[model samples]
Target: MMPASSATLHVVATPIGNLGDLSPRAQEVLRTVAAICAEDTRHTGQLLSQFGIATPLLALHDHNEEAIAGRLVARLLAGESLALVSDAGTPLVSDPGFRLVRAARAAGVRVSPVPGACAAIAALSVAGLPSDRFVFEGFLPAKAAARRERLQRLAGETGTLVFYESSHRIADSLADMVQAFGAARPAVVARELTKLFETVLDGDLEALLAAVQADGNQRKGEFVVMVQGAGDDEDAKVAEGRRLYARLNEHLPPSTAAKLAADLSGAPRKALYGG
Candidate 1:
């Protein structure tokens, strides 16, 4: 049982796709709170109606969050327990409500969490990729050039790379990923997780790209794309060799820099010098 406090703000997690995934505690928080702050009031209203919860909802999305946060915090400070929820999944994980949560904490109001389903976690669990240490990069840039540039920067990541992609751009994004990270790099595309037609496809980047392109149905839903990180040994050699080459080149001839860098980084001198 949640301890009822004087001025409490509950950060509740809601179901992403399957309504059954909503936890009992989260439902209780939504039901008992003085009001629920929602990213989309209409969407939340439907969910509450389904559960027979009659709690009043206050809209607090990205656009109006800054403007409304002060008023919501005042309500919390006035001894009204408030619950914060997003359109789906956990609040503030690629969703809105950060301002209000920050305001409530800064004002000394107690904030509690009601954990539940998250799309990224759901996808990662079934991605067949390394999950011990991973990074959740919410969404990639929309433009082709920018997206590829970002992927290029993340090519050397040592932990699994997770990203959320829309149905429209999933194909293009996967193609760019294949170019940025080598075609042989292992990757997975988890689509429409926890919902009907859920699909988790794993293979090398080239194969996954081909699969997504060939099957139009595969590109019709929300996606969580996971790419295997660079191998530690090769990544370290290339990265360290480049770094040493850059510094040594400033003080010595190109050949000498390449040789010294190769010796220090255990990388071939010809490879480091583009021979």
Candidate 2:
């Protein structure tokens, strides 16, 4: 059993873009820790050097985190406090360091968070969508078919949907969203948050897609795409009714399918009967 003095693991949040966002306490933790576990040592090194923090860095990223977590936990049990940081934003929030933090807690080492900049939260703050309840979907699947499939599954979600996306996929993803969620669905695309060229775009999915396609610069930064939730119960029922009517009409007569779908989905028959 480790003694009561087991070292702590500080999960630190670094700046997503602006260097000024790095809190004073985070700098102190980076300075005093025995070593900082970073997703990318070189990127973290550049950040530390800016503030003159000379703490040695140990590489701990997706590819190597599982293999090294045990070793890091052993060090914690040996009374050497360590800090874990991602290249940017909060650690383990779509970033690495999950394994190390889990291992440290499992081994009776205390784990604490030093929260600061998180792109998802930062974007949400500026997004005029509902903040009362929301979901953070880290990043959509990279492939087109898979991405569309995922969006289809979330079409009826009532809480605001938040997703992080790379610059290259922003346009395609928004297009897919318009297809899956409808052209008139409200959404916001927050790009390069906290950085000099930051832009937050607001409109229906169709308009947003058009803007991204028309402006090359709009598609050129890290993105936090937020979508307003599916509307009231009647709206959801109409959507479900239409989906069901399409499948049912293949076998049954159009009128019969519309009646059945409207009954099953709690939507008005007139809405599904026409098409």
Best by TM-score: 2
lDDT of 1 by residue, 113-225 (tens): 99998999998998889999998999999998788667766766788999999999999999988766668888999988888898899999999999999999998988999
Question: RMSD, each candidate, Å?
Answer: 4.6, 3.0
- Candidate 2, position 265, lDDT: 88
Backbone N/Cα/C clashes per model: 0, 0
The residue pairs in collision within model 1 are none
Give the whole-model CA lDDT for all candidates, comma-separated: 0.86, 0.90
- For candidate 1, the lDDT comes to 0.86
What TM-score does each of the candidates earn? 0.85, 0.90
Query: Model 1 — which ten-residue stretch has the worst lDDT?
Result: 1-10
Supply candidate 1's per-residue lDDT for 36: 94
**What tens-digit string does per-residue lDDT give for candidate 2 at 240-265?**
77667766888999999999989998
RMSD, model 2, all Cα superposed?
3.0
Model 2 poorest ten-residue lDDT run: 1-10
